[model samples]
Target: MRVMGIDPGTVVVGYGVIDSDAGRETMIAYGVLTASVKEKPAQRLSILYKSLEKIVLKFKPDAVAVETPFVSQNVSSALAIGRAQAVALLAATNRGIPTFEYSPAQVKQRVASYGASSKEQIQQMVKMQLGLSEIPKPSDAADALAVALCHLSEVHVSGLLGEQTPKRKRRSV
Candidate 1:
């Protein structure tokens, strides 16, 4: 199964695709989509949608794993990121893909064996997990891959689209 991971932001959206089978995951594609600060909020979201749409069309992932917006001291920044997060979800849902949202801490714990793992630790762990020679760059791409890997570790593709959804929602963990 292929999972598309997303790290959403107004200025930059990171995406990573990974294929998992028999408990092994291989990296398929990873990159960042950038939006200029000069663009308005709506324009940025539009760019994000179009960019993510193209990715979904190209990769044809079985599911999407999105990083939930992290809390920020700045309300405006947080809200902007929340909107971008919604766009990421929409990008997958529009294509009839099931999207799972995970927090940064969740990704870190699943990928690096710690909830407070550093960014460098995450990059290294992701690289090692996928057997990549070098760490994924731009930070965001690695983060996205981490998100994807987390979902793969926690849930299977069948669970993503089946009756497991309600059980997943009700789980305390």
Candidate 2:
């Protein structure tokens, strides 16, 4: 399956694409979308949405997995992240692709095998799992890749249990 993972943010939205087959995952692409901080909130979201939409069309992923925003004391920041996530969902769903969301903790547990794993640990593990020569640049991109990996792992486990689909939050366009 070809999966695209998103780590959404107002200023810098990260994305990663990968292909998984029979327990092997291969990196297809990883990068971030940036909008100037000086831009208005809505303008920034528009830029992100357009860029992400182009990516979705270009790669044509079979599924999209996005990381949900972590709880924060800064409510506004959290809300902005949520908006960014919605943009990702819309981009994929508009293309008639299925979408799934994973929490930051869930991503960490799946990629690093520990719920409380640090960012460096997750990055390192992602590198090792994909057999990359080095850690993926830009922490957000690495985090996005982890989200994709988490979804693949969940699906694999579900298949092992004789299920047709993984038990995850799913949204259709």
Candidate 3:
């Protein structure tokens, strides 16, 4: 399966692509799409949407996974992140690709075996899992990769469960 992961932000949106088959995985691409803070809010969103559209077209991933924004006391920041995440969803949905959402904690847990894993831990785990020589740059890209890995792990577990035979339920007297 080919998966594209997105970490949405108004100023810098991160993206990562990977292909998984059987048990092996390969990193296809990972990077960030930036928009100037000086631009108007609409323009910034436009920039992100268009850039993500181009990426979706180029890589043509089978599934798109996005990291949900971490809710915080900053209301405006949270709203902006939500808008950026919508852009990512549109980029995939417009192309008829399946999209999944994963919370930051879930991504961290799947990648690092702990829901509260630190950024450095996530970066290290992502690097080691992908067999990269060093941690992915700019942090955001590493985060995006973690999102993708989380989706991959979820799908793998689901598939394994699907393969198992179900036991019949018994009614109590």
Highest TM-score among the candidates is held by which one? 2
> What lDDT, from 0 to 1, does candidate 2 have?
0.91
The model with the greater lDDT, 1 or 3, is: 3
Q: Which stretches of candidate 3 lie over 4 Å from their true place?
A: 163-173
lDDT of 2 by residue, 36-111 (tens): 9999999999999999999999999998999999886988888989999999999999989989999999888888
For model 3, how does the per-residue alpha-carbon lDDT over 64-139 read when each residue is reduced to its tens digit?
8999889889988888898999889998988888788888998988999999999999999999999999998989
lDDT tens digits, residue span 7-122, model 1: 99999999999999888889999999999999998998999899999999999998888888878688888788989989988888888888888888988988998999999999
TM-score of structure candidate 2 = 0.97
Off by over 4 Å in 2: none
Off by over 4 Å in 1: 156-173
Models sorted by lDDT, best on top: 2, 3, 1
Ranking by TM-score: 2, 3, 1
Clashes in model 2: which pairs?
Answer: none
Q: After superposition, how far is residue 159 of candidate 1 from its true place, in Å?
A: 7.4
Which scores better on TM-score, 2 or 3?
2
TM-score of each: 0.90, 0.97, 0.93
Which one wins on lDDT? 2
